[model samples]
Target: MISVVIPVHNEEKNIEPLFREIVAALEPLGEPFEVLFVNDGSTDGTAEVLRRLKERDSRVRVLTMDRNRGEAAALTAGFFHARGEIVASMDGDGQNDPAYLPEMIRRLREGGYAVVSGWRMKRKEPLLTRRLPSWIANRIIGLVTGLRVHDNGCSLKVYRAEVVKRVQIPHGFHRFIPAIFGVKNHEVAEVRILDRPRRFGRTHYGLKRTFEVLRELLTIRFVLGNRVFYEKALLAGGLISGLLAVISLLSSHRPFWAPGAFLGGSFLFFFVWHNLRRFNQAQKEGVFHVRELEI
Candidate 1:
């Protein structure tokens, strides 16, 4: 069985059409599959469309959130609810072709890969607004994570259910799935997929998301480094600050405020490092609240 999870927000016009495409794409595989549409507090009739799809097909399931959580939270909720050995995720905007799912799943199984990500080599979006930022982001992500994934932003990916279920996905971290899986030494593969232009609704992403991606990259780097890296970083900072403090005291015109500020910065680094260690140990439960479940 395969579980295809889609996270949708205010995409009423595209829901039914995308469902039809999914059904057409998956029927040829001749395997039992379930489609899970996670409604991320959509203001439009997206929920109604999902409900209708569920009523028509027993394999359709709907998970409605209490409020508008981001894509990562919605995907997390769907992942938790999915019941299949093979789990797959794709965008709800109809830009991702469902036809490529079978090939991705095949690659995952045949290649013994834990994940098979989609790569839209020739995207259909605008150059400056969409492609440029995505290109920069992909390069930065590859450099930081060392995975060299061609398209980390593509949502069309297949994963082993057991592997993905073990991961704790935080908000705004959905784009780093390849890196997150790679950190655990999981084998990841990518396949070229067709990127269709959006037929309805505006894009949720923009240049602003690029900045958010940059900020989240720091968190990814931190996670990849673990506790030892942070400890070393703090030690280095403390050493630098201490040296500066000594130099200030030894100077003829001692700037007392400079040393105090340097010492304060060192202390601040240690404080954040300590809290981050504690945070890693703490349980992160209930990150997403579901308003309704129709499984």
Candidate 2:
């Protein structure tokens, strides 16, 4: 069985089309599957649309968030309720191809991969707004996380249920799940998927999302940050904190401010150092598993 989890944000119009295509893609496989749609506080008619979908198809289960919690949270909610041995996720805007799912599942099962991610080699979005930032961000994330997947931003990804259990996703971590999975040495495979122009709903991407992605990437790096990383962090923090403390000490107007800044920075430095030590000693759990359940 496979659990398909899709997170939708103000994508009411896309619901039916995506559902049909998903069904078309899965029907030939002749396997039991469930489609879980996580509605992230869609202010539009998305919730009502999903209700109609659920009524029409028993496999369609809608998880509604009271407020717009973002994709990562929605994904988390869907993940918890997914009852399949294999879990898959994709965008709700109908851009991702459901036909690739069978192949992805095959790669995960036969190719001995814990996760299979889709790559949109040819994106349809504009260069400056979508492609450019994705290209740069993918490179940066690849360098930082040391995972070699070509397209980290692509949402079409499949994870072995056990492998996904080991992953911890927070806000904004949706774009970097591959790297996060690599933390425990889980093997990841990438497959090419078709990217289509959205038939409905405006894109949620903007300058703000780019900045948010950058911040999340840094957070991932920090979580995966090692001894060497912390060493550099300590050195940088020490120097910056020391300089700020010293330079501000000379400021006769705000003399106490320097000490406070120094204290704050020192606390941060030691905190990272502490984490490094504890992380180094912690044992890494091997692949995990859960018994199959009815969807």
Best lDDT among the predictions, by candidate number: 1
TM-score of each: 0.84, 0.80
lDDT of each: 0.82, 0.77
Candidate 1 deviant stretches above 4 angstroms: 183-186, 227-283
Task: Kindly list the per-residue Cα lDDT of model 1 for residues 138-213, writing each as its tens digit.
Answer: 9988888888788999999999898777655666677888676543434888899879999899899888887668
Best by TM-score: 1
lDDT of 2 by residue, 1-295 (tens): 8999998999999999999999998888899999999888788999889888888789888777767867776876788778899999999998998989989999989988888999996788999988999899888888878887789889899998876665446566668886775533358888987789998989988767897776665455666656466656775786788777777777777756667878678766655555443333322421112222223
- State the displacement of the C-alpha of residue 223, model 2, in Å, after optimal TM-score superposition: 0.8
Q: Local error of candidate 1 at 162, Å?
A: 1.3
Q: Count the backbone clashes (under 3 Å) in each candidate.
A: 0, 0
Query: Which sections of candidate 2 miss by over 4 Å?
Result: 183-186, 225-248, 251-295
